[model samples]
Each structure stands twice: as structure tokens, then as C-alpha cells.
Target: MTKQSSTDEQGDSQSGSARSWWLKGLALCGFLAAIGVGYYFFADQLSLKAIAEKESALQEYRQAHPVLVYVLAFGLYAMVTGLSLPGAVPLSLAYGWFFDLVPAIILVSFASTTGATIAFLVSRYLLRDIVKSKFGERLSTFEESLESEGPFYLFTLRLIPAVPFFVLNIVMGLTPIRVVTFWWVSQLGMLAGTIVYVYAGHTVPSITELAEQGASGILSRQLIIAFIVLGTFPLVVKYAMKRWKGTDARN
Candidate 1:
């Protein structure tokens, strides 16, 4: 009877492992399919140049079907960002042009953070082991930073463009940070940058004009103010950390 029970337990374990592998494979296929569709079908449509050409048409469509346009825009923004594609900036600018500032900001913030969290989850569940296997030594530094600094390290990364946003999402996924922490930190950190992009879209006469001015045009007084905030954010974080540590020591 004992030998028979041991054989059954081993069979069950093997079956469970096989099931897990199948699920992971399915998920990887779905992810790749989404990426392929986004790249081939949607990438060009999301470009500023494409939007520039259809500006009048888009404006007309928005005016005719305001609610539908808003819903579609939000979904598209979320999907594009979730896939870590290249259309996020164009989408942001387009939203600002189509919608009012407050609406634009709200939509962009929630959609972006939501999409980022999706990417984070995907990395954590699907790609974490593969990534760790390949880059374990290099990734140890990030793991240590996340372990010691917790959400602050993530917050700083979100606030500053030091790391590409998508890369940060993927890297953070491999860490021990809670999903809720990742969501809120991403939402708040990306808020300022979102405002800048949306505001630029709102103010620009046309996408063509924005393209021509490029980074040069974006560096106006407002952008300089944003830079100042970015520069001082680290000092503020340092001060807060020091105070927190002092309090801990006292306890």
C-alpha cells in the first residue's frame, strides 16, 4: 500500500508540472500574437505622421462620436502601452489634441499605469525566469536596490526618465515589489511627464509643427520648470529617507 501511494503521488506531481508548462506556453503564444498584430496592423496608424494626415478627419470623427472616440482612444492607448510598443507618445499627443486637458490627463494617467502594470505582470509570470537566467549577475544590482529602497527606487525611476519606461516595468516585475505599489508609483511618477506631453499636444497647431520643432520646441519655460522639479526630486527623496531612518533608529 505505501509503495502504491508513492507511485500515485509521483504521477500527480508530473501531471501538475506538465499542466503548468502548457499554460505558460499558451500565454507566451498569446503575448507574441498580440505583439505581432500591434506591430503590423496598428503601428503606422498610431504614428504622428499618420495622425497629421488625418487630423481633419479625426477631429470630425471625434466631434460626431465623442463617447465612442474616447472609449476607443483609451483602449488603444492601454493596448499599445501594455504591449510595450512605440506608439505611446503619438497616442498621448493625439489624446490631448482630441480631448480637453483634464480629461486627457486622466485618461493618459490611468491607461498608462494600467498598461505598465500588465507588462510588469507579464514579465513577472512569463519572462522572469528566462531573464534571470541570462542576466542574473547584472540584475542582482536592481534586486538589491529594490530590496533596500523598496518603492522609492521605483518611484524615482518613474519620475525620472533615467530608464526607459517599458524596461523599468519589466525589470520591476522581476523584483519583490507589490503590484499595488507598482501601480500607484507608476501612476504618480508618470503624471508629470504625461502632463507635459498632453499640454504640448494641446498647444501645438499641428502634428507637423510639433515634429518640426521636436525636442527644441518642447524645451519651453514649462519644460524648464519640469526639469527643475526633476533635479530636486532626488534631494527630496534623500531627505525623506534620512528622516525615516532616524525615526527607525530611535525606535
Candidate 2:
């Protein structure tokens, strides 16, 4: 190649490589920031008593400061989710009880989706290269499948009980799914659980009962059942779709 042509080609390659590295750096920064914030907020875990206390005060505070409460609560919910913390589920249900399922589900769904997207972006940016390097061969088949079935695969994992959702959130980040795709899919996928939890909150007769249920272990059986049902619904939907398609073909 001529010197001029070779230099031009080298410049293009360098620019492309630099852009890739920049993306990697941004993702790493986000991931680390999330981890740091997670540790900061959740470092000294609150006791059930503390939860109960907060629950009782929630009503009075809401009554007293409606506007600030709404803004603060929504932002707090987003931050907790973005950081992949534990208490977001309960808070969603509380919204259901306090306002209603429609608003609660809408709010939490949007917030959670945004948070998951943030988490996903972080994973893709910072960890994808490392994960690909280590797990390339094993992940190759999975990656190919992801091109076709990634959304449903991700949806199933989201629906499944006992999966640490935050782990899934970040793990998904390293996948090939685009961030916009992840956001919409996650919003829809998480809607059912948000509905269930928010509905549960509406059933709570009193704020006191709501507080008691979380700790007294009363809600566990109910939540377990709900999760089991939630987890199975997608499987049922998938099967019905297949059965219907097969029947159509036969006809």
C-alpha cells in the first residue's frame, strides 16, 4: 500500500479502537459508581423494626408533605433500583397501597426499567470484554442464541423466583441486546411482578399491617405463591403460543 493510503487506513483503525476504549471506560466508571453507592446505602442494613418505623411514619409524612414526598420517593426508588438494592419491591407495594396499582405499577415500572438499563449499560461498557475473554467459547453458542431468543431468555430469568434480580440486571448488560431494547423489554417483563406487589399493597388493610406483614413472615407464604404463579405465567404463555401455532399449521 502507498504511504498516504496506509496512513489513512491506520488513522481510521485508531479512531475506531479509541471509540471502543472510550465506551469501555465509561461503562467501568458507571459500574463502579453503582457498586459504591450500593455499599453506601445498604452498608448498615436496617432492621425490621426500622422498616416498621418507617412504614408507620410514611402515612403521616405523606399527608403532611405530599409534593415533596412524591418527588423524593420516586427519585429514591430510582436510585435504589439503579444501585441494585433490595428494598425496592416493598416500596413498590407501598405505592400501590398508598395511591393505587395503576399509578404504582406505572411509576415503578418506568423507574425499574430505567435503572435496569443503567445497570445494563454499565455491564456492556465495563465488563463485556472481560466476560467475553474468559467465557468466549462457552458464551459463543449462547451469544448466537441471544441474537434470536435473548429477550424471552432474559424475560424467563426475570420471572423466575430466587434469582437475584440485580445480578441478572448487570449480567444482561454484557449481552448483545441494545439498551433501548433492554429498557422496553425489562419494563414489560417486570410489570407483572410490579402489579402483583402493588396489588398486594392494596390488600394491606392498614399501614401497620403492611409493616407487620413484611417481618412477621405473614407475607412470605403469599409472596412465595405469587412468585410461583408469576414465574409460571410466561411458560404457560409460551406453550399456548406454540400450541396455537401448531394447530394453525395443521389446519
Clash count of each predicted structure = 0, 0
Off by over 4 Å in 2: 1-27, 42-48, 131-150, 205-228, 248-251
What lDDT tens digits, residue by residue, belong to model 2 across residues 103-192?
777777887787777667665766777656765664565456577666776676666644467766666666677788777777778888
Distance from true location, Cα of 16 in model 2, Å: 8.1
Q: Could you tell me how far off, in angstroms, the CA of residue 121 lies in candidate 2 after the best superposition? A: 1.3
lDDT of 1 by residue, 116-234 (tens): 99999998998888767866775788889888877778778887778788888887788888899999988988887898888878877677766666657556787678768866777
Tell me the lDDT of model 1 at 21.
90
Task: Give the lDDT of residue 77 in candidate 1.
Answer: 89
Best model number under lDDT: 1
